[model samples]
Target chain A: MPADVTALELAGLRKSYGGQAAVREVDLRLPRGALLTLLGPSGCGKSTLLRMIAGFVEPSGGDIRINGRSVLALRPERRPTAMVFQSYALFPHMTVFDNVAFGLRLRATPRVEIADKVRRALALVRMDAFEARFPSELSGGQQQRVALARCLVVEPEILLLDEPFGALDRHLREEMQVEMRKLQRQLGVTMVVVTHDQEEALVLSDYIAVMRAGAIEQFAEPIELFDRPTNRFVASFMGVSNLVDGIVERDGEVSFRFPGGARLPVVSDLPAGPATLALRPEAVRLCAPDDAACRLTGTVAFTSLVGSRMSCEIKVGETVVTALVPRHGSGPAIGERVGMALAAEQLQLFAR
Target chain B: MRGGAMPLLMLPMAVLMALFFGAFAVFGFVSFLQPASGMPGYQGPLGLSNYLRFLTDPAALAILGETIVFAIVVTLASILLGYPLAYIMARSPYRVVRSLLLGALVLTFLSGSINRAYGWLILLGRRGVVNDALLALGLVDRPVALVYNWTGVFIALLHFTLPYFALTVFGSIRSVPVQVEEAARDLGAGPLSTFFRITVPITVPAIISGAALVFSLAISAFAFPLLLGGGRVRLISNYIYDQLFVAFNLPFAAASSTIFLVVAIATLCAFFWLEGAVTRRRAAKRGAA
Candidate 1:
């Protein structure tokens, strides 16, 4: 294998079950040491795509190459890939040391080398002291750590994770995510994570492949995915709620006009036609109804303090415009009148 | 569903236990009594005469040894025949195959044991179906001696217990999630290694229980031995039957029955002890983790 070759590649990956395609035409190239997340809602073929890469699910039409070598014909264990199952399928009968040493023993590795590798892998995941413990004795998060050590001990070419932290609580999940990110960086292992949580995807991935209906919607950096979604599905799926449907026009400067006399000038090169204006909730600054910078005015229908920001749902005529403002500075009380000013730099337009 | 009904249900269970326990107490008392004198009005003073007779007699010792051997052999043979079937029932991909195999097994179990033994007798006897086929195919010069012997008794007992062993093992195997096995494979274990290293140890408790059940059943078996043994291979149960009914030696029968009860309880207790050890280890493992 060439040094510069991609660590894992899926070319024209297609899978169908009983005449219905589960994943279709998904092509990906993951560089060594880069964490890529396949982000999608459940049943969107994201898990299927990850399983295909792991060689657990055989593709109906595709080639999965690891480090420039095709592994399509290889079994899951034979592939240079390991997966941390979502259920953290740790063996209940074996201690953590034996579980981590299982792969090495399968290859008939020397007994001393197996013990050393198992210990190093456990220490990498900070599970060194828990080696004698069985999985049944561990918490969900500790079980996941052992699972990671079990996979990492093999020193696989790539590690596939299927919602690895989905079982933990909010605080523990965040803690584990940071721990896993640090471990991944320290070891420099290419990782492909499958998750439905966009927040998790953003926090952990270098790039995200947003999938919908067995196809990739957008494959880009996390910031690019959040800030510049390519289509209406991507816009709504990314949790950007201000997707105002309207038509684009060239009146000296291109502007969009919606029903109820609402209009906004869109700085875009889109041809004059119907389009959707997407704005992030945080991109809208709140103002008084009489403020000149305010483009829309309405009474605040709902308000909640989220972290350091106040999330307000302002009823701008028929539309509910969500605006996040700092909680310290006059957070909108329920039923209070407020206005929204859109940030032009953060605005995105897509064809309806 | 009322809790009150629980105590009511126990009433009948208590009565049944009292009835059997009282009879067993009478048997115990009888075992300590002398053998019947010329008169049944009163035997000699209470003594361990029948117990001494049983311990010192070579014929009784042979019957006891044969029972243990029969139990061990049949238990092992049943496990060897059952574990694969159990694994297939638990892990087979096709629903029809698993259901059909289980259906046949359950159906065989539902059929009376004596009927099944007779069914086998018709198949394995000198002029039975198996001999007929072998002779028709010219595979044997003469009909093999399969029935009216220890082989017949062993085969019949295995047939009676195999479904039992397989069912228990199947439940144990099913209790284990498929992902655990897949995890073993994902961690680089091949199919054989996964089964031996992962599957077998996890299901050991079930295997032990199945072995205990088969052993106890085979040791105390009467119907299969009576019909199949054909007076040639008498087990402890068959000998006890003769001691009580044919020889009219009630004290000796009572003495041997008490020993039989002790042996059965001991074997089952050993299995339960093993099961508890496995469970405790699992609990300790979980607590440590």
Candidate 2:
């Protein structure tokens, strides 16, 4: 209950559907006013976790504490939380004002107070002008904003959104993501968002909980997750990354030896054995061949022009290593031999 | 899309009006004819004697009152039983249960209403299964009079009306997005309050349409009411029948049928208009609120 404590905490949170676990040992401590993104692919238990927090899905085992108090026994409405559903869930019969005022009305708030709160919440989401319009009349972005207003009007301790902007177009999605992030900061309300888009997660969340196979793979700041992913799944799942199979040789110098005999010296305490060495596309520097601790010479097999970067796939013996270089820079053409330098700091060693 | 076909489309409309409503139009015209009492057809020098007799006859008036009361009560009773059953069928979590309920409904529908009414007659008759069970259970000392009265007719009619009520209510409730109701609960509405605030308000159109259907069917019901009501309970349709075949007065029967048709049409129109107006008013109120 302390002011510095987390707004929400899950201790050994688990959910099973007929003996198969949907969420496994989900332990999280979401700080007050912090926006945490439950980042994962579909069926990775992010939505299930969010629903458990919302009390829509009861945990098979564990404690869900909101504001440092256990709320597993409370119904969704009794909990100090509100959710912005993936479908927006706006009542078809109600106007924008009524939809936004839905939560307040349930609380038996006075007419004048409800009106004021609804207006303020709508204005917070920049949807004040659309009060008289029905949800069917609004665009996707407008409806999402109204959904947010509906949650905000309730003044819940935390706000949960499941793929909050999944229904919007690419342009509108990006715009709403930024706008919602700003609103979260402005309101200083704790939020837990579920999304599979890593870039959106990075841009919107203060911390990202990368989930896979019904368990949290890593829960850390977005920058840390991008740079120092705890496992190969996180490293490869985040974006384009080269996971070359190799064995660590820790004699005299720690170096990775691929099955094809290509060597890249790595710094790791992992015992000498087979491993998957992770290197980001951005971290693989293209350089002239020379005697270096972490360098490999390979021929570029393909080059894909992606935004302002040319992502080239290089073949080093039987392994294809992907690397990103700026588009404007001089780089190896397809079938050209090139020397690739791997940064040791960026090398993620995952033991088999 | 085909602006030029507007007049051509009226061809079907004209044909339908001529084939169907044309009979009623003829009846309306005949209702104004003066006829000798108890005559099979009018010996006319056009007058309003038939219509006036229909309006002033005591037996006809009683039958009219009986028909209206029967229809209203049947509509309400059907709704009370139907809404909950429909709600269950619509929201049943198990697909098997939903399918079974729907299958039973369709099977019942495939069987003619008259056959079903007769089935109900067998079940509710004094010497039938229901009364026998009641007697065996010591719930009744002797067989009670269920048939040959309004109660028998009502029960028989309800058996047919329930299916309409269920199907319409089920469709209307099913059309409401499940997420909307979940959203209501998430917003702190209890189950009952959520039903009143979200489910019921949204399904009003279906309720009104279903009620109108049941009401119209009940009022014009002929065979079931005649079979069950026997000689005690006479409805407008029975009276119309008596005037036609029993008394052999075609002009008076035609006049009475015309009045019944007009009233049924008027009731349907008023209900629909009321539904539309209420929807608009709700929209306006919510917008202003």
Specify the highest-DockQ model's number.
Answer: 2
- Please provide, for model 2 over B55-135, each residue's C-alpha lDDT reduced to its tens digit, 9 standing for 90 to 100: 898878778877888898999998999888888899898999999988887787678977877887798898999999999
Model 1 DockQ (Cα-based): 0.50
Task: Give TM-scores of the second chain, every candidate.
Answer: 0.90, 0.92
CAPRI verdict on model 2?
medium
After superposing candidate 2 on the true structure, give the runs of residues whose Cα lies further than 4 Å from its correct spot.
Answer: A1-3, A291-294, A327-330, B1-17, B36-39
Model 1 agreement with the true structure over A168-225: per-residue lDDT tens digits? 9999999988888888888888999999988898889877999998999999998999
- List pairs with backbone clashes in candidate 1: A137-B286
Error of 2 at B149 (Å): 1.3
Q: Which run of 10 residues does model 1 chain A get worst, by summed lDDT?
A: A1-10
lDDT (Cα, tens digit) per residue for candidate 1, span B1-289: 7777898989999999999999999988888887665433226589887788888999898888889888999999988999999999999999999999999999988999888888988999999999999999999999999989999999888989999899989999999988888888777877898899999999998999998888888889999989988789898999989888787777888899988788779878988998899888877865664
lDDT of 1 at A242: 81
Interface RMSD for each predicted structure: 3.0, 1.6
lDDT of 1 at A309: 91
